[model samples]
Target: MGILEKISEIEKEIQRTQKNKATEYHLGLLKAKLARYRAQLLEGSKTSGPKGEGFDVMKSGDARVALVGFPSVGKSTLLSTLTSTTSECASYEFTTLTCIPGVIEHNGASIQLLDLPGIIEGAAAGKGRGRQVISVARTADIVVMMLDALKGDIQKELLTKELEAVGIRLNKKRPNIYFKEKKGGGISITATCILTKISERMINLILHEYKIFNADVVFRDDCGTEEFIDVVVGKRKYMPCLYVYNKIDQISIEEVDRIAWQPHCVVISCNMLLNLEHLKEMIWRYLHLITVYTKKPGKKPDFNDGLILRSNCTVEHACHAIHRTLVQNFKYAQVWGHSAKYNGQHVGLSHKLSHEDVLLVTKK
Candidate 1:
């Protein structure tokens, strides 16, 4: 079974524990979400199944980083290079016919990296299984856009334009406003219009230009770039992504230097046996994971429920992630790192957690 299945098993075990009302409620919420996603997976409409599987599996809540790019762009090559899973890599197009998953290790933690089939031109229009690829792209927490360095800047620019032109804004906040004649009597849309602070005229002009004035939209500021457009104009999800320039060994040092200088771009060489370790490190950094450990009596230290947090996570959020009730009824936490000579330090909820910190959360 996958990580999600393992998590479900854990939750089921938690629910089976008699009289643990809180755990049961939490498990119920997780199950409801899982059921909704399973229904979506069985729907099998429009790029549904191929990419849809990722969404269904991911909604059960696992950290996912997706590999996406054009055909023959070495996405599969990179996946095999960085992880234990060996997917078929070819010299020609569409080698990855479906979503291929691999477990990659970084900082002593394993993260899920999905190698999705290539996204070609007219992907949104379902050309050459583009919709299928985009569907996988929609579900990822982080998207790694694998580019053929040999294809050069024109190809890069074209993809960037294509991603942004459809109003797939990245890292922007947009409100989810629902318009209603009565309760649940009209269409529902995710809001993609990010100019929430601007004037009504500006908003109207933007909507007219995008042709989204006729819909009820939900604003998802944290959604992916592609999903941003879908939420605003249609019901779609947006995912966050990083651009990975693959086949770096084929490019000259000077060319590599030029591409590396691109802001926030992570360039890596994937030549079957190249810097695979370094590539995995970069993936971890891109995912924003900081390793920590969970201690259990007489058992080996497990990273499971060790709080896989974003780099920006504070002690408060980490506390909540450990157990929602802890955050609600927080007292103080004792934290100790391997480097620390002290046994532990008592701190408030906002205290930022560090790598290898063993935390004991106390609640009143």
Candidate 2:
């Protein structure tokens, strides 16, 4: 049988098998095998994608958010409505054949939004341009999973599965596992917290299946078998996702209310421009951006256009963000804002910055 067939058989066997202490190791092994085969499939797709090596859209602005969904899901409309850039919008399917770029300027921060071609069923299996589109998603800081209000829940499930099949883990932090490969010693595993999910034996089995015989592992959090597997594979993309239900103007209030209740979801009508400001606010909130106004020596701070930084950012981060090589020069910075205890407090590169903070960097 082929690899795909073998994967199918293993999946069937796993499904038939019962879950308990007796079959846990077996299940883990099966999952490891499945992961290996999937990895192989992904490796094959690297060069075989519809757009060989996948088409590239230049990254711009402070951050990138990918709009992904089935065809005719209002992705193009949403893009044109939010930004000045216009993506070809049509009533038919597959209107967007490539990545369309737009920028959303909100609260003095510019965010790049990409409208990719619609994904169809089995898109993850190199069907259509799904894999290539997913490649863009992997690079994005956030994924806006646009959905048709008529049947969004089902679409959400399908889109989630497709993204997962290609190693995209949404709204999840990376596994708190540290690993080091040793020259000759066997695998060594340590955990800072109690591993309540799978045992160390199962971990070893999975690692061995991946041909990892000598390594050191430290789990800082309660990670599950899949997380451990991801660590072993080491290509998973963990990012935030916003489920946007569009075309709500065509749906009923009762239906709209249902989807709005879902976590990390927003209901909007791109055609009618309904709740778009709210959507923008949610996007900004999800991005967790901090505005930092710059102050040149002997000049006032520029409040109109401030530098956008991510939350928990510091003076060094601001320096690097403004200029890639600015951090190389040793320097001190002055800060005045919510982050500083007093006005014009002198702070070092390590000094953390808060929203609407004023920064004055002095170079070496």
Candidate 3:
């Protein structure tokens, strides 16, 4: 579906879900944000190309990785190589006027990549269009700092130090957050920080500088329920990014190897369009999304037509994905593959499917 449609649907669902609940200020803020997103979607559908006005917005959940660095750093050029996006690329600065999303496909699974405008030094100070791109970077799952390899190490160190000074941890653990809707009418979010390359020392430094720890404190208000605010936490427990050392053709192989020695960082020649497969493999392994097969009564098992689920996804989620009614009246499911002990075994709705599973559902 188009972004506008998705936003409209989410807006409708939010309204339906919140009908009986005492709406919070955050919920209202979410609505206003979504409305603005809907407007952007409408505008985007009616036009093409980045106009001179401001940065172009991307639909929520479209981008998994965001490319951020100084201007004329080959971000646009890399976008052209990875995805079908036709972003304007030139040697001059400010070529990318907006956040452009492109797909990077690996082993048939694709991840969305965002090519954001350059972020200069003192960007958070609101100089050099810094505020605009920083807002874009805040939403990104992975932030890639692309450097011009030919510019040498002195320039690279300067950019790295600037990001560090701004309280961005170069190495840290990144954890995933989960949001749960309670029966009582409010949403609850639970999360754990994964132990990662991002050091605790760095996280503490950023938290102190950004005042994230104070913002994250959970306390009880006059109400009976608990209240907790989200914080700008540390990186996820795991490294979810490939340090793209773009323009490898411009630098020596020894330099590339030296740069790769940086903890949790990898060197790649996006300019040479080299080692793209290796990068894709890294993503697949990181995400843990494996290929599974689905079987029809009279047909051979088809891997391409099968849905990709989490390594630990419940049968309930799969049933809902297949059809809504199946979940409401789901009785027993006959399965094959890893989830099934035997070739064809009957299991309950709570079954956790594995790779190469064939399931047949029987509803009550």
lDDT of each: 0.60, 0.89, 0.58
Q: After superposition, how far is residue 226 of candidate 3 from its true place, in Å?
A: 25
**Residue 43 of model 3, lDDT score:** 41
Candidate 3 overall lDDT versus native: 0.58
Candidate 1, residue 152: how far the Cα is off, in Å: 3.6
**Where is the poorest 10-residue window by lDDT in model 2?**
46-55
Q: lDDT for model 1, please.
A: 0.60
Which of 2 and 3 is the better model by lDDT? 2
lDDT of 2: 0.89
TM-score of each: 0.63, 0.92, 0.60
Q: Write the per-residue lDDT of candidate 2 for residues 1-364, one digit (tens) a residue.
A: 8767877788799999999989989999998898888788888878762563425988999889999999999999999999999989999999889888999999998899999899998887778987888888898889999999999999999999899878999988898899777887899999999999979999899989988899999999999898899889878999899999998998889988988998999999998899999999888888888899998998999999898999999899899878888888847888999999999998998999999999998889
lDDT by residue (tens digit), candidate 3, 65-177: 66777888788887888788878998788888777888887555566777888877655444576555654555555566677667635546665544542334444432232
Which residue pairs in model 2 clash with each other? Answer: none
Superior by lDDT: candidate 1 or candidate 3:
1
Using TM-score as the measure, which candidate wins?
A: 2
Best model number under lDDT: 2
